[model samples]
Target: MMESMISSRIDIIKPSGIRKFFDIVTQMEDVISLGVGEPDFATPWHVREEAIYALEKGRTNYTSNSGLLELRQEISRYLATSYQINYKPETEVLVTVGASEAIDLAMRALINPGDEVLIPEPSYVSYSPCVILAGGVPVAVPTTEKTDFRLTSADLASCITDKTKILILPYPNNPTGAIMDRENLIDIAQVLRQHNILIISDEIYSELTYDGEHVSIAAIEGMYDRTLVINGFSKSFAMTGWRLGYAAGPEVLIAAMTKIHQYAIMCCPTISQYAAVEALRNGMDSVKRMQEEYDRRRKLLVHGFNEIGLECFEPKGAFYVFPCIRSLNMTSEEFCDQLLKTERVAVVPGNAFGDSGEGYIRCSYAYSLANLQTALERIGRFVARVKQA
Candidate 1:
């Protein structure tokens, strides 16, 4: 039997809900997809042109195991000025394929077999699997709509056991769109310090916060020494395809991650590093304009869902809304599949994110306004039809 030859670990994971929706949406015509995680905008013209110029000049080889010095310096400055996190670019940062790769690298570098990784539930799909692959167990702590989906320090404390080696802090979070304020972060930092645990802080959506400015755990006293801050151009600069991201932490940890990067990716795309420098230096204007658009869409979708009788939270960060649909008496998967087959509007089932996501569905507002309005109309009709029967 192939079971003897194939690794058992591979069977523990399956195709992702995000990937499943993507496959169906690609085959369907005229589908209004709000399930996408990437920004709808193109990379700014100047940023794109930088990559073009780099290619024309024949700078197409690997830069370094880490990344170009100029790009890393730009990232250091960007994080310092924007979030007040001080990172020495030369010793503390390692550029990776994307934030996705950075997450994988961080888990692989830090985790050991039988160690536990404390995670907040209803988060991005990658955290748990990456931990599993790293030979660590995932300990998911659920967050709720009552708490605005913010994972509190007490939540962190309650989840801790002696075997817990790391905590994955994903704020300005995915799916639910919740964000933690400074006071919340300080309290969590205290808990982390008390337990002597490390943190993998994924701030990929840092620039996309709407209610207030983004904050970093590393900015707090005693936090920098124990935190790995992950960021990239994909969310902020409309540069998802550029596939460039970086991790900043202690020199020892960054070195371990860089060794993995050297063997696995060798180097991030050279052109992307050039484009990211432009993005970091001149991309704020583009980010502001894009955030404005997302805000408008956010308001529209939240209002639209409520108008049609779906109770949902107004997300504080990122571009998604997690709407509770238990009133319809259908499971999240059933609702999503029926909606897709009937109205051709693709939104992901909440259960895809975690157990706390049941009875809900997640919709990204990263689509155009026209599509949002059309999706609303179709969803409204569908809801009416289902309720009538």
Candidate 2:
């Protein structure tokens, strides 16, 4: 207050575009919100029971700084079984507060001042800000709906410079629901192998893929040593409130991330770690049921948007539908605001994800079919009214 005590680095970061809209949604009555990228389902019963059991048994004490060895071993098995990637639970796996914390830790451990971090845009919101906070320059590489929002080797080549240090690979991407297949990752890997860059692959939505199995870049040849795979129980296991995630990679980088995590977080919540262990070991049936329901909502929302003239590309992963709203002749923010004020149906403006997202709006399909139907009806009315004017 005396002399503007906030550091310039903190000043440079913008508030999350997602939460900014969500704040407004909370104030309005009967507003059907499609804004937040959160699962609408409750945490699976078995997983919740595990946490409850932990608390009942007085399992409230902190585990090792690297997190419970049992949980890490479960994470190791889950990764190996699901993705054919193996990480030693003892040395290579470090559990953290969430994938959010893991992402921050990775950035803090890897970035040097003025280093460049290539973030594929129209992706998750946290990547850029975390890089800036870590003293790195964030270079947003735009990907288009033309290629289904997948970052290509050519795109990688164009953005590379001597200063590029880390590439944030967010697949099964947020906002757009785009996923990078093996071929897409292989192309990008070839380009990255030539550079001294490391990769932070956020695979939080890996289990939510609708088309084929999700691919992790670390499993790709020539990439394992250079890739830190960030994943968690938040998305796939419907455990967002649990605050548990883990990172696996070459021990060197994992060790570095663990060092920061130990100082910053020490470990995740003890009960959440127990819940997540149950999630890894036995929550697949619940995950499948949720994914199936989200798929139903996804189909309904995409069809409804197209019928209303908001043409949305079918997203192959995650639970969001990014639809082009440019034909309505408004900025994404303007469109979202007007829609909220008029119909009370809330979705985030796509620009919240990146500037590349300006002409679109991201509608999450994680709600009930009844809610989705109501929101869709209201949105259709909004689109018609705008077009007629």
Best by lDDT: 2
Residue pairs clashing in model 1 are none
Off by over 4 Å in 1: 1-4, 14-23
lDDT of 2 by residue, 1-389 (tens): 94588777777898765676677889999888898788988899999998899999999998998899999999999999999999999999999988999999999999999999999989888899999999999999999999999999999899999999999999899989999999999999889989999999999999999968988998999899898999998899888988888899989888888889888888789999999889889999999999999989999999999999998999999999999998988999999999999999888999988999999999998899999999999999999999999
Across residues 1-389, which tens digit of lDDT does each residue of candidate 1 receive? 87789887877777675566667778999888888999999998999998899999998998988999999999899888998888898989999899999999999999989999998989999999899888999999999898899989888899999999999999989989999889889988888888878999999998889879889999988999999999999999999998989999999999999988899999999999988988899989999999999999999999999999999788989999998999999999889989999999899899899989998999999999998999999989998888898
TM-score of each: 0.96, 0.98
Q: In model 2, which regions exceed 4 Å deviation?
A: 15-22
Instruction: Give the whole-model CA lDDT for all candidates, comma-separated.
Output: 0.91, 0.92
TM-score of 1: 0.96
By summed lDDT, the worst window of 10 consecutive residues in model 2 runs over 14-23
- Model 1 has an lDDT value of 0.91
